[model samples]
Target: MHAMTLRLSPGDDLRAALDHAFRTHALSAAYVLQGIGSLSVARLRYAGRDDAAELRGDIEILTLAGTLSAQGPHLHMSIADADGRVVGGHVAPGCIVRTTAELVIAHLPGERYTREHDAATGFAELVIRAS
Candidate 1:
């Protein structure tokens, strides 16, 4: 396994940065080890919602973790607003950084990963390849 650290700058889209890493590194399988930072805008899809809710403000990222693949990342994040109200959900695109975002990703060289629609879950879920 190998690891990488990324620092996102102001105006950088959170999801886009991570997606670029997945493609640029050619990671067959990877996971978001940790993520911390701040954002000016957060696009999050609440539970059982098809669309995302946009929260605009100075938000501090509390938690960010999930699986990553070439197909896309199934990431979840929690952020605290300026008033200290916490909100979190499935991370979507258009999450713009206000200051910086520091992230750690673990790359698994021996594993192959993919996402496929599952009838049971009604969502495209992770499929782990055998080592």
Candidate 2:
């Protein structure tokens, strides 16, 4: 497995940047080791809810870790608002950066991964294709 470090600048979309990096590196399987940064606009899908919630304000990214595939990323994150209130859920696209975000992604070669819609769960769950 190979590793990569990414620093997102202001105005950069958090999820978009990661997606671009994975595509640029042609990574079939990867995991975001750590992500620390801040965001101005956050898009998170709160758990137990079908729709996503938008958190707009200065927020600090607390925890970020998940899987990345050609289909998309299954990332979860927790962010703190101005008052230090923490909100966390499934990460969605459109999380724009406010200042800078430092992230490390580990690429797993010699294997492949994919996501397919599962009838039972009604979601595109992780479907490992290789060991």
Candidate 3:
């Protein structure tokens, strides 16, 4: 596993910047180690939910983890508002960075990742081939 440290700028958007990083690094797959930062405006959609709810206030990212694929990332995050009210959900499109987000990403071998249809789940999922 190769690790990289990333620093998000004040005006940088979280997912957007990460997407750029993937492209720049030519990464086929990666995972967020953990993220710690603040967000002035956060938009999160928890799994099993149809839509995202907008959060407008000071918030801190508690836990951030996800998978980066060719299709995109399937990220989830837990955040707390100014009052320490915590909420977690599926990462949506509107999670804007406030001050900065310091995070680490680990890249996996490109050939190790493959997709195949699964009858049980009825979807194309990651299938790690044996080395």
Residue runs of model 2 more than 4 Å from their true location after superposition: none
- TM-score for all predictions? 0.97, 0.95, 0.86
Total backbone collisions for each predicted model: 0, 0, 1
Which candidate number has the best TM-score? 1
For model 2 the local lDDT of residue 5 reads: 96
Give the distance in Å from residue 53's predicted Cα in candidate 3 to where it truly belongs: 1.0
Q: Which ten residues in a row have the lowest lDDT in candidate 1?
A: 122-131
lDDT of 3 at 74: 66
Give residue 58's error in model 1 in angstroms.
0.4
lDDT agreement of model 2 with the native: 0.91
The whole-model lDDT of each prediction reads: 0.94, 0.91, 0.81
Query: Which candidate order results from sorting by lDDT in descending order?
Result: 1, 2, 3
- For candidate 3, lDDT tens digit of each residue in 1-131? 89999989776778877778877888877888899998888888876777999998788999988876665666789999999999999888768888989889998864444456899988677666433
Write down the lDDT that model 1 would get.
Answer: 0.94
Please list the residue runs of candidate 3 whose C-alpha ends up more than 4 Å from where it truly belongs after superposition.
110-131
